[model samples]
Target: MSIDQHGDHVLQGMSIRKLPKVSLHDHLDGGVRPATIVELADQVGLEVPEDTADDLADWIAERSDSGSLVEYLKTFDLTVGVMQTREGLTRVAREFVEDLAADGVIYGEVRWAPEQHLSGGLSLEEVVEAVQDGIEEGEDAAEQAGHDIRVGQLITAMRHTDRSLEIARLAVEWRERGAVGFDIAGPEDGFLPSRHREAFDYLASEFFPVTVHAGEAAGLDSIRSALLDGRALRLGHGVRIAEDLDVVSRAGDEVLVQFGDLARWVRDREIPLELSPSSNLQTGAISAWGEELADHPFDLLYQLGFSVTVNVDNRTMSRTSLTRELALLAETFEYDLDDLEVFQLNAAAGAFLPVEEREELIELIGEGFER
Candidate 1:
């Protein structure tokens, strides 16, 4: 199987982009389109690194590819800068959904921090309402374009901030409107999920779904805190959870390993790990293992019955889509259509939706893969 320049892959004599998929770790700010960024920046007198969309796209890819923390962070600065108003938020959200639908993502959870978009004087409730409006518009547009897609909001709070309890309450308040879950994003190391224990405790009381950004920039302790304190229903790029595994021996495809108590618990509990392949490499989340997709412990976790779901952590920065991530994984791991379908099934099951809707997504994946 070969992936085209457009990121489309022909696997098992079928277009990988045509297969129904579910995305659980996609970031709204991290996935903005270059053209949209340029236009929005112009409206706000924001100086962008590039003038044209193509140049801006290349600029983003270059900076992200640098693998420097400074460069990677600069990308977010640009995305978050233009998304400060109701108009910007709604348009970006709509485009996000449209892009996901075009990429064959039937269902997705868009995670972003409302606190980041409040620089324009928008209230928490106002920002959530604006995003929901855009989501509805995007869904209608996708349906009219002959694609059915659904995206829910995963309202996130920055870990470095102290307003998590407030953010958690905001998420729960908007639960029926658009917010489907809560999350703590931002620098993962130094700041553990336990730091937001009050927020987690309140979310638990409200019976809200939470997914913490752990095991990405940090290690085992972060994952443990995410599970025990945050009560995370899913993990955001929990790639480093492999740190808990001791690979005893490996002979070709045959291998033996000992699992740590945390690893065993996570695996046994079937907790979903939202693993983003290219982003994992770009962020050095799997630096301990190796510097390539082949080195990712995704296949290991999958083979061991860990609910591993593929994701595109940042579409613009990594210059990736869910289809491309899956294609890269397939090329690296020699995964077939069945394996891809299983990843999608895992994401659908791990979604913050209720059981009935998740079952519909599972059925859709099975049917799509059958074709």
Candidate 2:
């Protein structure tokens, strides 16, 4: 099985890109097309590092591959800078959904922080509405193109900011208007989910779905805070939870392991880990394991009974898609079509959609894979 230039591989005589998939950890700003960024930046009179879209994409990718989350996050400045207006936000959101559909995503949840896009004088509600408009348009366009896709918004707040409570309110207010969930992204080391307990408490009171960025840049303590304080239904790149696992021994397809309480609870409860292979490597989230895709603890966590899901945390930064991430994992771990299907199933189950909707997505995935 050989992967093509687009990171597509044929397994069992089927192209990975044609398989139905679910995306739960995708970021809206992080997935913007470089061409769109260049065009939007020009309209807004913002200076970009590169003039052409291809060169700009290469610039962003090279800078983002710095292997440090802080430095990697700095790349967002350009994306967010261009997305401060209604038109910019809507266009980006629309293109994001369209890209997901083209990649064979049947269902996706797009996460982006509203606070970061308010610099253009748009209100919080306005930005959410803008993105919603784009999502609807993208969905319609994809349907016209014979690719049925649905995307929901995960209204996110920057972890280092004090707007969590406000953003929680914004997300809940727009719950019926395409907002599906809430999240806290940005730096994770210094800002624990506990810092936003008030916001989490409000969300819990309102019964809003929440996912926290934890166990990536930090370790078990961050994961604990996310579960205990943020009431996270899913963990964003919770790869570092592997730190709690003590690998006693290893053999071909069999390994002895000692699990700490945190690891045991997370595994036993089957908390979904949004593992982004290429993004995890670029951001140094899985540095403890190694510097390559093969070093990811994804196989270990999967074998240990953890609900592991594949994702493209940032498509532009990582230069990946769900198809590519799955293909890379299959190539690295020798996974078969069945394994790829399981990852999609995990994502469907962990999606911020209603149970019936999730079940429907699972059925769609099954049928697609069967075909």
Clashes (N, CA, C under 3 Å) per candidate: 0, 0
lDDT score, residue 58, model 1? 90
> Could you give candidate 1's per-residue lDDT for residues 7-76 as a string of tens digits?
7888899898889999899899998999999999999989998899999999888888754434576689
Per-residue accuracy of model 2 over 29-95 as CA lDDT, tens digit each:
8999999999999999999999999999899999999899999999999999999999999999999
Clashing pairs in 1: none
Pairs that clash in candidate 2:
none
Candidate 1, superposed: residue stretches over 4 Å from native: 1-5, 68-71
lDDT of 1: 0.91
* lDDT of model 1, residue 184: 96
